[model samples]
Target: MKRIRSPQKTAEKLLLAVMTLFAAVASVIFLLPTVLTITNSFMAQSEINANYGVVFSSVSGGSKTFISEKVNLKFIPDIVSFSQYFSVLFKTPDYLLKFWNSVILTVPVVIFQTAVALFASYGFARLTGKLKEILFFFYIVLMLMPYQVTLVPNYLVADKLGLLNTRWAIILPGIFSPFAVFLLTKAMKRIPKTYFEAAMLDGASELQIFTNICFPMVRSAVFSVLMLVFIDYWNMVEQPLILLNDEQMHPLSIFLSKINTGDTGLAFAVAVIYMTPSLLMFLYGEEYLVEGITYSGGIKG
Candidate 1:
């Protein structure tokens, strides 16, 4: 007599194997575009323009090329040189400086917006008043509005305030986000009122309660808001394009568009470099961004 196996068990194992193979194929299909772009960037101009079937001689001023072997996409050339990175990083002078400008502009925006949103959120969360509800509603409306509608008003105010052609045109507006207020206020509300009352009983001022008590309680929410703010301002193209006329003040996002036509390679290189900081920041802070959504909003919210 032999041990018996159920047909159901066999079916389940077969299903799982098919699903796993499908997932692996899906992953490769999605990543193939990015992988190809990065790989192609390292290929020499000759290789880039090389006929799909024609294999060219590497020697300069050589005779007609022949395609004998399938060109391996994995390993591009004998040596992968940094010529593209070097030219984009060095040959482009003022355009490259736009990177630092973006950094400076974004750092201030993140700090100021996060701070303002935290306080505004505290008001909407804890303070008792009809005005608070009204103000909160207004912020929600403004936040939900499209960027195009808001751009004109923002430009006018920036102009009247003499913020045009300056970093402030972008930074100042970014500092006050309704989305941040909405997210953070919900986070703050989740904290039990008992803590606030307890702090008040101990003669703690609102500032003290906010700094010492409330701040610690909602640390994860802050990270979530910071992530959004960083991405929004870091990729800013329209605002800088409209607000700042000075080439020097334009952020990398705006500057990248300027040189896009002449050389596609440099644009790709700059874009790859420009997107690095936001990627690194989010990768490291992903846990907190994800944690805040769960702990503070919807379902458990």
Candidate 2:
């Protein structure tokens, strides 16, 4: 006997297929630039210049002109070369310095910001009062506000504190950022009150309960926040550019634009290197990130 699908079931299956196809296409579209950069980074500089020189070339008399020639967008290089990476890694000291500067500025922010958010989130999760709600609301407001809106104030405050022109200007604000607090607080709140009750009945002190119960339950959320905060600070441009007047103090992100204009070939290689940390972090923490985000208020048995 032939099995027949109901009209409603057939429609649902069709919709699912359509959505899946759309998602696949969207994913490829999103990944296209990353794929292009990685592949093109391996092309020899002469080949890169031959392919993209027209796009980057300036008109005479120091003026910009629209590209008259179509750019050759090659996915596979005729010849692969490591010269660009070699130059960025070994031949150039400035590139390495800026890369280290990015690391120096980003690592401390990720570590300390996660620490501060964990404690602050625990407070928000456990406390119950109009005051706590009001304060948490303020944090949401600050998080919602565009960083550009607060950049000027941050500048003024950093100037007053004599942190301008120093790495502290970038690190301090990032360490106390409210985004992680907002996320971790929500995650901690999702943990059942029964767990806390059990801990309290066991004579667990606040610190002990926080460390053993809350922290363990919210571990995935912590990883998610760390990955997020790392990505945010790793790609920071405006903060360092505005706060640090010393060109040498600027992170690689600040130098990326200049590199793009001057050495297009180097830009591709540097961009790949710049992307590596965030990419690796994401790949490693992807499962935790999804679990942390989608987890509901239920304790796993």
Candidate 3:
């Protein structure tokens, strides 16, 4: 005889189905813009203009009226052209320069920030006292504060140090950001005290334990912090815009807005190039990122 399912089991199954459907829909919604950008980047300039002219025209024209025009959100172009890419990659030296500027400014921040966080986190993890707790609390507070709130202080400090209009203005602040410190400290603290005690008992110095034991255990978290910090600085626009006075020194993130004022198609092409580094980094480190975050939070995976 066929067995009947219980009402509770059926209800649970129904709930699961609903949740899955919601997740799928949300994923699509979130990914739609990225899909659109990648697809539109391949479209010919004429076609891009035809599809988006209504929206851009309104903005450029400085119209105060609400845009009632329906934009043609085409995922596929009638003709796929490489001209935009060709122009952005070859013809536009300025675009390439700005791209390099972004790389120059972002790379140092990622490298130094991770290095600083590693040592600082180690101290916070190993040391125990009211002072350590208080200091860690302050780091958390700084991390929690929105960047906007800290922008003025950064600006003032940069000016006082005569770092205004320089890459150092942005790099210095990012290098000392508290986000990585807080994350790494949490991850390090989760390591059992027995590991350190055993290492010490065996005549391992603090530096040796840090390098051989602590570093190995938290390697995934370090990778996670590197990727996260790289992505954060790579997309920075406000910092460069405010700090660097010379337009030529501004990163691609800032230049992207300027591209919109000119060739709208070029904006899409440049955006694809701009995001390529971040996308590649994320794809490569995705597994490490997830594992790091999981273990750091004391969650078993």
Structural similarity to truth (TM-score) of each candidate: 0.79, 0.96, 0.94
Cα lDDT of model 3 by residue, 1-301, tens digit: 9999999999999999999999999999998998899999999989988889766664546543456788899999898998999998899899999999999999999999999999999999999899999999999999999898999999999999999999899999999999999999999998889999999999999999999999888988999999999988888878987889999899998888777767899988899998889999889999999999889834364
**lDDT per residue, candidate 2, 153-219, as tens digits?**
9999999999999999999999999999999999999888998999899999999999999998888
* Clashing pairs for predicted structure model 2, backbone only: none
Worst 10 residues of 1 by lDDT: 51-60
Q: lDDT values of the candidates?
A: 0.79, 0.91, 0.90
Worst 10 residues of 3 by lDDT: 58-67
Pull out the clashing pairs in model 1: none
Return the TM-score for candidate 2, rounded to 2 decimals.
Answer: 0.96
Q: Is 1 or 3 the stronger prediction by TM-score?
A: 3
lDDT of predicted model 2? 0.91
Error of 1 at 175 (Å): 1.2
Q: Which pairs in model 3 have colliding backbones?
A: none
Query: 1-301 in candidate 1: lDDT tens per residue?
Result: 9989899999999999999999999999987766665765575544544523233333445445554777655435545756767887788787579899999889998998898988888888888888888888898899889888999999999999999999888888888867888899999988888888999999999999999988887888899988988898888888888998987888888777655444544654676787788879888998989988789732343
Candidate 3 local distance difference test against the native: 0.90
Best by TM-score: 2
Number of the candidate with higher TM-score, 1 or 2: 2
